[model samples]
Target: MSFNNLMIYRHPCIVKYVSSWQKNCKFYLAVEEVTPLSHVLPLLNTLQICVGLHSILKALHFLHEKASVSHNNICISSIYVTRDGSWKLGGMEYLCRYEDLSSDFLNKSRMNRYFKAVDSNEEKVFVNPTARRDFIDVYAFGVLVYEVFKSRESFDEVPNLDVFCDYCRNELQHTDPSQRPILSSILKHDFFNHEFINIHSFLIELPLKSDEEKMLFFRSLVGRLKMFNEEVVASQLGNLLLSRMVLLNGVAQETIVPFLLTPKSDEQEQTDQLFSEDTFKKYISPKLLEIISVRDAQIRLLLLNNFSNFMYMFTKEELQMYFLPELLVGIKDTNDHLVSVTLRTLADLVPVLGAATVIGGKRAKLFNDGRPMAHSNKNLPKEGTPQENEHPVVRDQILNNSISSIIDSHNLILPERSRPDGEEVETSTEEIEQSVDEDLENWDDWDLNENHSILINRLGIADIIEDSNDIAENHSNEGIKSIVNTKGDLARSKKTIADIEELDIKSQVQNNENDSFDFFHDMEPVINSSSKFLINEDNKCDVSLGIDKEVSSKLALNVNDINEEGWGDGDWD
Candidate 1:
């Protein structure tokens, strides 16, 4: 019945349970069986020896201190080896509940002289279950710790090894169980302190025998990745252990990416810092490259989710050379899931690594599967029209458009911000957020290692699709003409339709209701015209539905010609 209660205990130091069955009246419990610890001792390395002693004592400590159970027989023979290259304490059937100081008839079962619990009243041949449980395990553990180091000839110079061994022997064999030292004290012994500062490297390297263990291993690794102070050890664990596990058996990208994006220490629920540099160099880069190489859509989606984080680590050339091709492929992909993920990643990257998305050393080509891919190094079109070669009026027109786009934060904003210098600054929501990486309340005053200028080169959605096919019909033809007449006109139109709408909403919030312009019906972008380039003054260039429209912009061209002598109202053809 106690063993049934004990079966619920889950820890790395305990044997794993799988299933149970009954035959006739007796029941059989099936569990994972492995090599005996007694056989693995001589072959153990320094790290392994430290971890093994820790694990064995850890199980005994948990059993006595946590579960209030006692292993009447505690020794090397009772300790089992697991397939994971670690040790576990088992033989639970010989376990007993911790009782108050009382009689014990355990001599028959306590045959291991090294581990036997003695009583002052030798004839009584009994021990107090409650008082004896923890101390008994602690004393036995001390002996085990001694045995672990006794095999090492190199430890000959370790001054206190023999003395520590003698101390453990005296403590374990002491007739007064109350006099024995506890597990923690033995762990702090000079023998262990000088040799093993940490046992994580040894235990962490052991193979995970099941999916559950693998999951736990990864979660633990990621959890520890935020230990910025212990970065070197953490890096080695992630790069070596994490890489090996992922290669041998893959992990769900969803499961791992979130951990990668937001790292935490043991104290905080949300953390702003991690050993990001080392993590990127060792863990993120290799894992990402390997995962991307697989070409799995779902896995790729997971990768896309974390691409924003990747921007800070990768240089512009690396992103352009490595990431852009696959992203282009994702954009043209027919699979809705892959396309969505790919587009999202690009959408995030454009604002931060905008230049990287431009067709660079390789050109985007229509590939098999009807997707676009980077084919070869070809000259991408140069930016802006050669205004130098155009007529004066055309040259001024290109300049005006260029200046307007730059002022709008690449056409991403609508509302104008008033600056203290009396200059109105209009920028995007992205621009405002980019200045400082504040996350509402949790974070403030910290800036990511990214610049806003990259976003300046980013063409909005309208720009990317403007030359595609029928997308031009949805836009103002006047704006379209300027975009068509000049190279990178589409790229120059920085704001997406959604961005404009958002800006519209924001501007409306700040303005009087009547101040709103009915753009679809009345508002039209005035063409840039000069005295020498004026068309016929008879016809006004109007897109309105035969109605007066609220002309909001100062840059709107006058339909009527203005002369130096006097102003005359006349339509332009």
Candidate 2:
């Protein structure tokens, strides 16, 4: 191997190093024994994919940033999944620091099929040899991501491919190195989404440097408390984070409400293990009230986004107490995004309220016509943690678009009752739909240039792109492809590299930037409630309950039918 020092390091993803000795002219490399990643193709699951990808990303990050080296070859054969299902990135034989190698050397060293990355300028792929080859890791990371998601029985079958961004099923083959988002950004991306895979663990911090560092540091503090301050740790975290989110006891607990977030109970689990009832009541609830009290559009939107996580964690009382009132308030907000997130959140909330009505006496009374008008906004110290908005910008973006907004599968209209003086009533479902259609028509007419390219407007109606998240190159990318039907537009398929090619690989989204939303279909009725439902064309992960008239019209899907699983457990990547 070129870099013998590779034997010295240790990382969870990297194979553990053991001592090696040379006998005669022959040299021996003793290391932990593990099967090749290629050896375990059939055994891999979405959870293993997340665990492995994250481990590889972290391993690459450590190698590139800390050690100033990049694994020249990051491929299936080189990597290995641990017995516990965690991935271990190996292939130290190809390790190369930022050396000023000649083009010939680079060419010989890299496997043009996957390792070689084309530069943005599109001259020669390996033009500069002196600069850090960090982007290669990014490109490789993208390729590996494709391979992991698009599995195969053997290495030959693992074809190069693209991923489905909320916008399109685009190629991961980015020709440019700089265009590839960095390791830090990649970690936070919704693409490597722990939620989607139901991995139940995600420790990726925000994409912003300051925010990422702040979160990582606070996480370190939490870790130290467990390591050294075991006695006072639990309460200490409560005092510090103002919530017991630290003592995450798989809040994907035995809890149920009117609606379910996931279709299957066993397949569902809470990864983020956040916003437990007590956590919300003591820490998150107060902050939300602060935001609701002030009513700043941007801040309120951000706060709502941040606070929206509580909905998944809400019980009947918690939903009626915190999420329902605040989210309904947000529905009245002028901003499209705010209304979008609030409404989708409301879609998730109503079932819980209904469940309360189904199971409890009049706990749903909180949701009556005389309910509160709208959600407000508040200002917390920007330097606070997730418990206190330490990195508000990243926190807000992640919470709003990715967490709250993107999953906006439905909306409802609060029908108005007749006044004793015979005053006018609230807007009917038809009228509200008409008004929404008119606004959409006006907005689309202005932005849409029909018969040209597809319109790329920020028209949100569902979850954040996700309130979401990434590119790559080299090798044959032909074969069966999976397509996510987002807006039911063929134009999307055409516009994207949905049909693959070598060049013009657009960058994959690593955040909820410039993402759009589509309108959902309405529901009839269920549970004697006036709330109608809207179902996003794409996300059918939750119950799509809706009918008409009485009983049968009552389209109340069980709250996730069985408590839908939660999000990332905040475990570090």
Which candidate has the top score in lDDT?
1
Q: How does candidate 1 fare on TM-score?
A: 0.37
Clashing pairs in 1: 99-130, 104-126, 104-127, 410-494, 411-495, 537-570, 537-571, 538-571, 539-571, 539-572
User: Candidate 1 on 1-573: residue-level lDDT in tens?
Assistant: 324644777666787777787789988776786678778767655545555666666677667678777665566776777644567776665566755323443545445334333333332324332344465555556556665676677744444667767887887556676777776676567766532223253334446356776666555555554442334334323434334345444552435546554434347545534444644555456545555655767656766776776655666766766787778887787799888888777777677666445533655555658555442212222221111122445434433444335434333432333232212134433544442222212222111224322221222223322222222223333343444343344333322322222233333333434655543322433222111211223332343211112223322345563332332365332
Steric clash count of candidate 1: 10
Q: RMSD for each model, in Å, please?
A: 26.4, 41.4
The superposed Cα distance between candidate 1 and the true structure at residue 85, in angstroms, equals: 2.0
List the global CA lDDT of all models.
0.50, 0.42
* Candidate 1: segments with Cα more than 4 A from true spot: 1-6, 24-27, 100-105, 111-132, 156-163, 190-573
Q: Which parts of model 2 have CA positions greater than 4 angstroms off?
A: 111-132, 152-172, 193-573
Structural similarity to truth (TM-score) of each candidate: 0.37, 0.32
Minimal lDDT window, size 10, model 1: 380-389
lDDT, residue 92, candidate 1: 61
lDDT of 2 by residue, 129-224 (tens): 444367655656566666666643333211221333311113234555545566776666655553322122322221223545444544433223
